[model samples]
Target chain A: MLEDGNLVFAACIILMTAATYFTRAGGLFIISKITPPPRISAFLNHVPASILVAIIVPSLAGKGPAEFISAAITAAAAVFTRNLILSLLTGLICISTLRAFVF
Target chain B: MKTSTNKSPGTRVVFSGKGIAEGFLKCIPLGIGVFAYGIVFGVLAVQAGMTPLQAQIMSLTVFAGASQLMALELWADHLPVLALTATVFAVNLRHLLMGAAMRDWLVRLPPSKTYFSLFFLTDESWALSVREMASGRKDAGFFLGSGLCIYVFWNSATGLGATMSSLVDRYFRDPSVLGLDFAFTAVFLSLLIFFWKGKSQLPVWLIAGIVAWLFFLVLPGKWYIILGGLAGGIVGALRDA
Candidate 1:
């Protein structure tokens, strides 16, 4: 509750830990008791990928048009190649080189 | 093979330990970047009038990089304590679902153990755990193995990073020269590729990208994350439906 630097850190630890626990606990508690509907299960299955796109796309939005276009290219390469590391490295090289040279 | 067959409860302990070791080892490059990033957080904590011990404790306890950064930003802006508190809570709201998913594994542990382990949960840990859990990992010990590895290294690295930043900077000079800044986007893109599944999901992904860009332009604050996620989820579901 206090704003002292140390206290703030302590508070964050306690608050974040508690919040994370409650969310997980809610799912574990409820899901264990009942069989989730097929629809719900399907939704849960997609959640992680949805969340990933959720987090990534916004950050990419802040870039320039060329960066955006190249990133799209990079994403396409990733899908086509199905190589995680390669795709990411390609995106990094694309964006960083663009940043270093173009802008 | 014989080592893998050692049928002792200590086997669980040993496996957990080995898993932790491997996890830590795998995390080295990523960990180094995290350490560099931690320095920035540490400096901000110290600047905000926190003692070194307090700064270490933040890394020890809270341990979420984004949440910590947001909290520091809010503090610097002189936001009310309540507002700062609320902002921290809101920023970390996703972890609640993460925690809930891990609850069954948690239920097996003693109250004290579960209580303590919960303290170390973060986005990275949760991401790692969810990956393991979704693949139907039955052993609570596997998570303990992975999660503990993450917890120890993260805190130690942050504490050490914060403690050494001044001296490290003087010796190393221009830490940004290391190119650690782009690691997150790189990591995300890597994970994204790994999770893409197949061509069926491509349109959904594209729609998600477009929605996120539109939301970022139209919305303020971090709503882009939420809006983009919901928008993407709906599109994904509708296509499958």
Candidate 2:
């Protein structure tokens, strides 16, 4: 399939693959070459949770009541059970049920 | 590249079959969640006019779900090569920070080991590895092993979704109806519990969430995520500094 008609598409894939691999390896590649300043390292430390929150907030804000309630339920389930899968299951079930019957 | 395999602040990096196996086994549950997304992506790719083979190739090579889905949005008769690749870079820019966080956890290993492990890095794998390392288990192999688990489920589900797109489309017209749309949100909401550093970090999250919401309203594409995440990171870093 990639042989005859898909050369441009294939090139796009290659470019994407290269660009992605760069991002994945670039941080270590740069850090290995030179030491990052303390503040920069601090920034990295905060980015993980910050990014997670950033991703979640916009998504959660865009949703409605069932979504908000389910998220709260999921967070509570996770804290109480200390189980990721169980909490996710609870959230999924809660949302499905609410969307079906309540909402 | 000045890395000392001889010394670290704490736990020694452990690379072994047992560690890898432990990582692999621990990730099975998360892998099931990943499979759901994979099937969703596969079904969408088919609808977007991609052949299953093409979708699998994209999945195998690019290996990032968000970027792949974005590519589909930008897909056309003649692909917008620059736009497609640029968006890929933008969406994955978070990885630069994530990979750097691995610096200490990975510095002790050889370049071969480091790069090999880094290639498989994804958000889920990185999360598991971070927790494992934080808990003082030194198995560097956990990153690779968990990533492999995700890789298996994600790719296999892609194939299944691509092949069975019709059945999925007919049955599940709206992923929201099944709450499949909330899978990642659910995953991240729960992760926030573990990442919660207490009231001290509340301001950072509050700022991040507010900034993200504002930008989501104003900007297009995935820029809000990056901008909002950076805003949180900057505020948190300033407080720490």
Candidate 3:
């Protein structure tokens, strides 16, 4: 895998593609196959958001001032604007300016 | 007029051209935003060392913006196949709901069209198609049409961004100074906001974050996310029980 980059690259991409398609099709077909209990359903529902929280929290912790402050501001903007792009822009602008001059 | 109810076995759902046209037209504005966002991905893909052909193929096959961008963040000189695929699945798992939600509406269409439409499902297209279906528009082809609009714009913008990447590189040599380092972080933060259900889920999120942070400090790799996510869910289940 390390020696041959292209082959590994193509193989990885194919695997990713398959994984993505599985989620799309699985929900369509397999969802009707087995019924999950309500507790299981609650777990399933909460899992994705938890996963996102897992990804975001570690990312925010122990970061520099610029990145940290920018993230806070971005979260605020996201709550207000609810626009991903706008929130992203707010973070980028804040981080850029803060990194340049403040912190 | 169609209502937002499951079709009876005898009911016929027409995948009409008019539905497709309306879906496509209604999505044009959203598609424009997707195009611009695709450019950012394109530029980032190039920065991550993907050739234009490689990036385009990923875009063509995956056709998912958030997951694709997230994959690029995990890209490396030597591809960590497990990490990359796992991260992609974790991020894209939300699609399962979007897919199941469409079951009532799309199941009435022919299996071929129904399954094909799932290939193009994105957040924007899904939202538009669901709204239309709920608004008495039973045109199953609408989902396909809206997805196609986004597909075209996203691919075109990706190519353009790949070509223009050199210009961006020239202007912004240090990505950190330009705040590009925070791009993925910003995306994730906003996603967290969108996914925030309510104060009820706060305990779940808190446990997930604390567990994830612990593992991130003590261990390596992305497994922290899965472990933390599962732990949080289990906590939620226990809380409810």
| DockQ, every prediction | 0.36, 0.71, 0.45
Per-residue lDDT of B1-241 in model 3, one digit per residue for the tens?
3223334665456776777777888777567667767878888999899998888988898888878888898898978998988877876775675566565467666667777878888766766675556446666878888888989989987887777888855664444555655766776677678766579989889998999899879865455666777788789888886
What is the per-residue lDDT of model 1 for residues A6-70, given as tens digits with 9 covering 90 to 100?
46555555765555446434444565456666655555555556656766777665657645755
Where does model 3 exceed 4 Å of error? A1-16, A27-29, A77-89, B1-51, B63-154, B161-168, B172-184, B187-191, B194-198, B215-225
Candidate 1 residue spans exceeding 4 A from truth: A1-17, A20-34, A64-103, B1-22, B76-79, B98-119, B128-146, B168-177, B214-223, B238-241
**lDDT head-to-head 2 vs 3, winner:** 2
In order of the candidates, what TM-score does chain B achieve?
A: 0.71, 0.87, 0.68
What lDDT does model 3 reach?
0.76
What is the C-alpha lDDT profile of model 3 across A26-61, one tens digit per residue?
A: 776665545667786666556656766787788778
lDDT of 2 at A98: 90
What tens digits encode model 1's per-residue C-alpha lDDT throughout B43-127?
Answer: 6676665566766776665666776777776665333556655665666665544555564455445545455555666555555
How well does model 2 score by local distance difference test?
0.82
Give the poorly placed runs of model 2, Cα more than 4 Å off: A1-4, B1-9
After best superposition, candidate 2 residue B97: deviation in angstroms?
1.7
**Candidate 3 CAPRI classification by DockQ:** acceptable
